[model samples]
Target chain A: MFKNGKCIFIAFILSLLATPIMVAAEYGDVLINNYSDEAGMRPVVFPHWFHRIRFRCKVCHADLGFKMEAGGNQINMLKIIDGEYCGACHNGEVAWAVENCDICHTGKPGQPTQVHQSTASKLTTTTKRKQAESVE
Target chain B: MKFKHSLYILPLSLSFALLAAEPSWRTLVEDGLHDPTSPAIGVLQEPASALSLLPPDTTGNQVSWIRALREGYIEPRTNILPETKIEVLDMDIIMEKTGELSLVMFPHKPHTEWLDCANCHDKIFVEKVDANPINMFAILSGEYCGQCHGAVAFPLTECNRCHSVARSSFTGKPGVQPISVSD
Candidate 1:
C-alpha cells in the first residue's frame, strides 16, 4: 500500500509538469488589429505560425518599421491593395492576391462564408510541402 | 485586556498622526515634484525630410501628417549634454558582510549621451527620489540597470565599474558590476 501511494504521488508531480505544455499547445490562433478610435471596428487576424515559416521577421517588422507592440502598425485596405504594406508580398506572386477581400476580411459577423477555394487549395499544397520536408 | 487594546490603538493613532503630518496634494504637486523650469521635449515637432517620401492626399481625405508625426515622437530629453550642469552621486558596494558602505561617484552627463531618457528616468531613478522603489532583484533580472548593462551598451561582467576599488576585507556578492565605459 505504501509503494502504491508513493507511485501515485510521483505521477501527480509529473502531471503537474506536463500541464503548461498542454496549455501552450491549445493556443494556435493569432489576433491582429489596426489601432482605431472608432467604437466598433472588426480587426483583421493574421496567423503568425503560417507566415513565420514562409517569411522572415525582418521582412515585415524591421524592414517596414512596424512597432514591436501589437495594434501599433497603421494599415489600410487602400494602402495594402496599392502594394504598400501586406500587398508588397501578397501580390499574386508570394501568397494570395489583394483583390480577394474575403481572404482577409473573412466577411461580416453571422454572414454566409464567401469561400476562396483557390487559396484554400493552395494552403493544402503548402502544408504537403512542409510535411514532405519533415519526412526527409 | 486593556493593555492589548491600547497596543493596537497606539499603532492606529501613530498612523493617523503620520497621515495628518503629510503634505497636502496641492503642496506635494506644486513643490515636492521635480518641477523643471523648461523641460526639453525630445523629437522634432515638424515633419523631417525623411518622412516626405510618404504619399500625400490631394483632397485632404487622409489623416493629417502633423497629427501622425506628433503621435509617433513623444519622448523626454535626457540632461546629459556636455555644457549642462551635472551632479554625481556616490554608490556603495558591499565587498564582504561587514555592513560597510563604500562610495563610488557616478557621472551623469556622459552616461546620458549614450542612453535614451526612458532608459533610466522612471525606471532606475524616479522623477522624485522618495518615490523610487528600486528592487535589487528586479535590477538583476533585467528590469532597470540590467536592460542595457548586459545588452547593446555594455556587458556587466567587470567587477571594478561600480565598485571602483577592491575592498580588502569585503566579501558579499556584487550587486551589478559596471560594464566598459568606452564604446
Candidate 2:
C-alpha cells in the first residue's frame, strides 16, 4: 500500500510538471505568414522545436534579430532573399535555401491559417480597447 | 535729490553686475539645456551627454544600480542577449485602485540592455498572463520584480523613475493589457 501511494504521488507530480510543458510546446510551433497568404502563397508552419534542439533561443531571437512575439518582426520575401532576416541562416550554405518554399509553407488550402493576421490585429485592438476602457 | 541719485545708481550697478555674471540666454541654448521661447523643451530633451560620464567601480559588493548597468556589470550579457538592436516595449499595467500612485511605464529596452529575457521570465515572473500579483509590499519583501530590482538592480526608492507614466493621461481610460511572451 505504501509503495502504491509513493507511485501515485510521483505520477501526480509528473503530471503537474508535464501539464505546463505540454502547453509551452504549442508556442514553439509558430506560423510565419508575414506575406505568404497575403501574396497568394501558403503560410509557413515554422517548427520551432526542430531549430530549438540544435540552437539556443538567443541564436534566432537575439543574434538573428527575431522578435519573441510572432508577427512582431516584419519579415518579407524580399528581405529574406536579400540575405537580411531569415536569409542570414537559411542561405544555401547555412541551413536551407530561401527558394525552398514547400518546406516552410506547409499549410493546406480551404482552411484559414492557424496564425491569421486579422486575429492578431484583433487581439492588439482588443488589448488596447480593454486598457482604454479600464481608465474610463 | 543727491540721495535719490545714489539709490538709483546703486540699483543700476547691481543689475549690471547680475547680468554680467549670469550666463546669457543664448549661452543656455548653446548648452542644449534651455530654450527661452519654450521652457518645457529643456525637460523633453534627451540627456545624450549622460553616457559620456565615466562608469563607477562595479566590484559585485557595493555599487549604484545605474552605474552597474552602464558599465556592463549585470548578468545575462552578450551570451544571452546577443541582439545589439534595442527593442523598447511600453508595458503599462493598470492595477486595482489602492491609493494615489502613478502608473508604471516599464521601458523594456533599458533592462534588456543589461539582462536577457530569462533573467525575469519563468523564475521571478511566470510567462502566463495575470499570474503574479506584484505590488510594492511583495517587491520590498523580495518577490517578483524585487528579485533583482532592490537587491542588485535599481532600488524602489526612485519612485518617479518607474512610475513616470502620468496618472492623468490614463485617468478615465482603459489601460493596455499586459503582453506575455511565453518562454
Candidate 3:
C-alpha cells in the first residue's frame, strides 16, 4: 500500500547503491594514497584550493615538480623530510610545520589517489565511498 | 563491604569505556572552505567552520574558480618568490583528428593563466604533435584532456566547448583520425 511515487523513488535510490560510480570530490581536491594506504595511514587529502589560494600553480606544479596527474608524483615521507615537494614550503617558517600528521593525512583509509570530479560531487552523499573502481 | 565497592566500580568502568571512543572527523577532509578566523561574518559557514563566500558553479569542483579570479576574490602569486618573472604562452593547437565532430582547440592562453609550460610540455603533452597521440577514449579514461576536463576543469560532456572549429571551414580536408595512438 505504499504510494506509487514513493515506491519509485525508493527503488531509484536503491539502484544507485547497487551501482558503483566514481567518488565525487570537490574540484581541484585530490586524495594522495600512493603509499599512505599500504603504510597503514589514511589517504592524504590534498585540498588544491587551499594551497592554490595562497600560491600560484607554478609554485607547486613546476617549481615543486608535482605532476598534473593524481598519484603521478611519487611522494614519500623520506622525500618530504629531505626538504622537497611539500616540505619546501611546509617547513617551520613558510607554513605550518609537518608535526601534525592528521592535518594532511585526513582521507578515509583505503581511499585511492584521484582528482575530485563534478558529476559525482552531487552524488557524494549517495556514493558508497568504496575504492575508486570508477577511475582505475 | 566488597559488594558495595563492586557496585561503585561497574558504572565507573562503563562510563570510562564510553569516554575512550574516538570521534570521527570525516568532513574536515572534504572540499570546503576551512576558514579558521570566521572573519567574514556575512557568509554562512559550515558547522566545522568553512565559509561559503566563493562564487557557486554547477560543474567542475562546483566552484567558479575563474569567476572568483575575475571578481578579485583571490590573487595567487606566480611563485613563492614574488620577483620571479611569469610568462604566458599565447598559442592555440587544433586537433583535426577528431572524427566527425568539430576540431578540438587546445588553448595555451587559458591554461597558462594557471599553469606553466613545464607543467604539461614533457609530462602531459610531450612535445605536442602526435608524439602523444590522443583520442576521446584516452581522454575519457583520464589520460589526456580527461585529466582536467572530467575532474576539475569541466566535464567532457560540454563537447562543443573544445570542439569549437567546424570541420567544413578547414582549407583542404579535415585530417583523418590517427590509426594507432602512440604511448
Specify the highest-DockQ model's number.
Answer: 3
Predicted candidate 2 versus true structure: per-residue lDDT over A1-136, tens digit per residue:
4699899999999989886311111222455566676677655555442353334444566566665545667888788888876787788976778877656655432232232222222234656846765997
Taking chain A of model 2 alone, its TM-score versus the true chain A equals 0.60
What's the true lDDT of residue A116 in model 1?
Answer: 17
Off by over 4 Å in 2: A1-27, A109-136, B1-183
Docking class of 2: incorrect
Instruction: Report the lDDT tens digits of candidate 2 across residue range B1-183.
Output: 999899899999999998765322122123221223333234322222221132432221123334444455433324323444434344544443435777665555556554457656776677654566778877665567655454334445556666765667765433444552111
lDDT (tens digit, per residue) of candidate 1 on A84-119: 767877789766777665345421232111111111
Q: TM-score of chain B, per candidate?
A: 0.32, 0.47, 0.59
Clash count of each predicted structure: 6, 11, 1
Per residue, candidate 3 scores C-alpha lDDT tens digits across A47-112 of: 765665567788887777777778888988788878888888878878776876766666667655
Error of 3 at B59 (Å): 0.6
Lowest summed lDDT window (length 10), candidate 3 chain A? A118-127
Worst 10 residues of 2 chain B by lDDT: B25-34
| Candidate 1 CAPRI category | incorrect
Error of 1 at B87 (Å): 40
- The 0-to-1 C-alpha lDDT of every candidate, in the order given, reads 0.38, 0.50, 0.65
Task: Find the candidate with the highest lDDT and give its number.
Answer: 3
